[model samples]
Structures are given as C-alpha cells and as structure tokens.
Target chain A: MIDEIVAAPGAGRALLDDYLARYAPGARARGMVLEQVLVAPPVWLDDQSNTLTIRWSLANAGAWWGMRAVSGADSAVAAWWAEVDARAISRRRSFATAPEAIVRLCDV
Target chain B: MFRLTQLVTLADRAARDDLAAALRAVGRRARSLLVEPTLEGSFNGGDLLVHASFNAAGDRAAFELEAQALLGRPATASIDSVSYSSEADGREPGLRDGIYRVLLLSIEPGTDRDTVARFEAELLAMPRHIAAIRNWRLSRVEQAAGARAWTHVWEQEFADAGGLLDAYMLHPYHWAHIDRWFDPECPERIVDARLCHSFCRVDRSAISSGG
Candidate 1:
C-alpha cells in the first residue's frame, strides 16, 4: 500500500494542480472532495476542521513546539494555500505558525 | 563542552512510524548509542509523539547536564532550528509541523570557539546530517510558497542549480543574532555545517523515541 502511494509521484502533485485550476477562477465551490484526495491519505486527517497539527516536546525540555495547516472545503486545498501566500504577501493575513511557510508550496 | 540537536522530516506518517518502530524494536543495544523516549503517540493533528533518553557515554557529560535541566542550551549547543511542512489533515487552515527533538548538553570547563569548530567539522562530515537538513529545508521551502515558487526560489536555487544558498540560509528573524555565532574565517560554511549536524541528532532521537 505504501509502495503504491509512493510510486505515484505526480498523482499528489496533479491533484493539487487540478484543485488550483478549478478554484482559481473564483469557483467558490466545495473543496472538501479535493481536500480529501490531496491531503487525506498522506496526512492523518482531523475531520472537524480539515486541519492538521504536529506537536512535540523538546528533548528533556518543558516547552512544546507545534505547526498547523488548515483549508476550506469549498476551495481547492491548493487554492487555499495559494490564497494564504497571497494574503501573507498582501499583508491581509499573517502566519501565526511556522509550518505554513513550507505548506504553501504544495500548490507549486 | 557543547551539544547539538538534529531533526529529519519523514516523507510520510507511516514512514515516520516505521522508522520509529524499527528503532525501538532494536531495543537496549540501540539505546546504548543514543538517547530516546519510551512512550509514543501520533496526534490527530498529524505529528508523532516520542519520549526517550539519550544514550549514556563517557564524554556525554554535556548532554547529561542539560538533560537534568530539560532545557535546550543556547548558541553552543542549541545550534540549529529549522521547520518542515507536511500534508495537512485537511480540516484546518495551517500546515502540520514535524519536529525532531535533539537536546545538546554542555559540560566541563565550558565551550570555546575552537572546540565548537572541531565539533562542527565532525558533525557536518556525517552523511546522515546532510540528508536530514536537505529534506527538511526542501519541505520548509515548499510550505512557504507554492511548489513552483519554492522550486524557482529555494529548491532550484539550492538543490537544483547548486547555488550559494545550497549550504546555508539564515532564518529571517535570526539573521541578526546568527551573526554573533562564529569567528570571521568562514561563518556561512561553519554555521550551515553545524546546524545540519545538530538537526540530524534531533531527527535521530525522534526516530529512536518511536520505537
């Protein structure tokens, strides 16, 4: 199962590409279907919000570090990410988490 | 004495778990070489949990001291900090973060420039350290922008084109403070090499914790 998924390099990238193509034109469509495909299998999906958080404690340290990614269902996951960059660049939105820095690349 | 932490981003959750489990199944024999945790869990948020101790060694005084405090030392030991973006759970508006925890302890008469330099050299020469940082940086750049943007700006500049950024780039906020880290001889090279090695140790610890 893992091998099959890993073998398909462009599949994940393509799914993301399709989401962008569909939503970039202001489709305002439900993005859940696309979200389910692009991110679900690879990530451990958290249904309530379609967002994932990774957390870990510093070795022997009391502090915990976390990173998060979220998307809207009506928009392509890639579209959501695109908008994130747009917003960050436009100063409309600020990244509260560091992980978003890398997650935004999924659209490329 | 100074310590370094290292971290590696697993390509996928299963890969992360598989590596962790593989490390754990090997048991005490492996534990003797490094520090690792005992409990493990993967959060609904897409990150994995690990609790382990560092392997005991004669020259491991620094690690042991910091481990007692459970605090990461700054500068000399806490050499590198990098982030990675992984596939999201799809319900949130942010990317999931994968962190490998590596704690370095400082021991003895204290760390000096020359000592750190030697350590930096040894650490960077290790293959595992280079591989982990390369993957982590790639994942980070991707999350910062779309794949195309990252490819054009980061990956293409570093990995694909073999540009100067290939070995080192400071975190935006840390650039100023990073300046004070090393002597003038080869700041960029040394810092990059040091950080890469530190991150590899963190990655190794995370894998060990899972098992």
Candidate 2:
C-alpha cells in the first residue's frame, strides 16, 4: 500500500520532491519508473488529526516497493518510509472536533 | 518590501492545485509566492495558505486583487500584517525547508489583562525552553472596514515536522505551562488557537538531479 504522511504544505511539497529525488537513483538502478501522480491538499475530516494533510500519490510503483519502504528493512529507503506508518498511526486518535470547538469558543 | 500572507479555505478540492498554479504564475512581480496546504490544523475556515511578498505595496495589492479573482467567491481570505518580527535584522534568510506553524488567536473576553500579558510574554519566550523552533513571528491582523475575528497571529518555524511534533506539541513546557491558557474549561481561555503549516517551495531541479 502507498503510505501517507501529513506536513505543512510547503514542507510537504519539498518532501515530495525530496522523496522522488532520493528514490530516483535506487529506482533507476532497479530499472523502475516512479512518477508522482497526485499532490493535493488534505481533506479535513472532523475525525482527522491533522487539519491540513498533504496527500501524495505516485504512479508505476508496486506493493513490494511500498512494503520495503515502510518496513525499513533496507537502510537506503528506510529513512523516507519509516515515518509513514508512524504518522498514520498517530493521526488515528482523532482531534476532528477540536477546531470546531475552538472556533465556537473564540469565534475565529 | 512587504509580504502579504493570506489564510484561505478552498471552496472545493478542485481549487487546490489550480489556485497554487495561479499564484505561482503571478511571476516576477512577486518576490516570492508560497502556497501551503494545512495538513493537520485549522483556523479562519482556511486550508490553503498563500504567502506572497513584493517590492512595493501597490504591487502587493494588485496581486491580492488577482488572487481574489482566481480564488473567486468560494474562498475567503484573511490578510495579516507583521506587528513584530525577529527578521528585521536582515540576517534571516528565506524560509527553510521545514514544518511551519501559523497560529491565529483571539483572547477570550473577561480574561485578566495581566494573564494576557503573561501569555504573550511566555509565547515569545518559548524558544528558550524548546529548542526545535527554527524561526517565528507574531503579527496582528490588518482589519478592513468590517469586524475582524482573530486579533493576534503567531507563527513558528520548526526544523522539521517531527521537531514541531516532539518539541512543541508534546513538550512538557507546552503541556504544563502553555496549554492551560487555552484550556476549554477555563472561562479565561487565553485565545482560540488556529494552527496551520507553512512550507518552502519544492526544489524541482534538485529532485530531477536525484540529490
């Protein structure tokens, strides 16, 4: 599965570029093509933790590559994918209603 | 040199990339154009962050008009003016690649004057206790003719997203000392805090170089 992480928008873009940059050599070495398919802003779910989550998608990559990246079994791609699962797990707790509550109280 | 930071909420998902591209195309007239998406926080009904700087205030206003036209009625824009910033020394370079948090706040009614003063003081003094903050600023909104909702704005730039998460969000000082002011239970909740992220534009050339 493709892993996702939330970041501030600019940082998210830089990260996406960085990820592609870092993965390009290894991917080319393996003769695989990696293309970023989508880079969109987060859909703020009331149940979501990050208010602005940048969702990134890549095309022409397989599950094996994703698994390797997530598992951190290989040091080369470990740094990039290691935090994917961690961020997803942390986002699971849900602070969805917090923003609404704050807005109600402060009226901003 | 004036920079206008507008916190905007997209009318729909479709407007995301279109608006970003439009802002970037504003071109040489703009010193810098940064479009940041809010990943994990919200304020002022905004999810998209648009920051643009210009050499002249007139150019900045012209850009705003163009931006509003592109954004259309579906989006709402709030412009903030820097009231106090540490970057006046000119030593600060362009925004670093990291997780930047922009906080919009309004002190609750009936809050003691001293408490408000202390809250602002401690907020500025946060770097002394937490080391992850790379740069930060506090600004007050330049209210237009109508009523303004948020009065104060606080911005913090972290070394990275993890640094923001660990050093600020989960810090002991933040939890023990800072969190209380914003406690929902307290009638004097210091302010309604709206958190958003700021990012540097991606370096496409570096990505292509595989660096």
The C-alpha lDDT values of all candidates are: 0.26, 0.49
Among the numbered candidates, top TM-score falls to 2
Docking class of 1: incorrect
Instruction: For candidate 2, give the DockQ.
Output: 0.01
Interface RMSD (Å), each candidate? 18.0, 18.9
Model 1 bad stretches (over 4 Å):
A1-108, B1-13, B29-174, B180-189, B193-211
Worst 10 residues of 2 chain B by lDDT: B202-211
lDDT of 1 by residue, B102-164 (tens): 222221234466855554444333223222233221122211111111110111011221111
What are the TM-scores, per candidate, against the unseen true structure?
A: 0.20, 0.52
Give the DockQ-based CAPRI class for model 2.
Answer: incorrect
Candidate 2 segments exceeding 4 Å error: A1-108, B40-45, B74-95, B109-115, B144-148, B193-211
Worst 10 residues of 1 chain B by lDDT: B149-158
The native-contact fractions of the candidates, in order shown, are: 0.00, 0.00
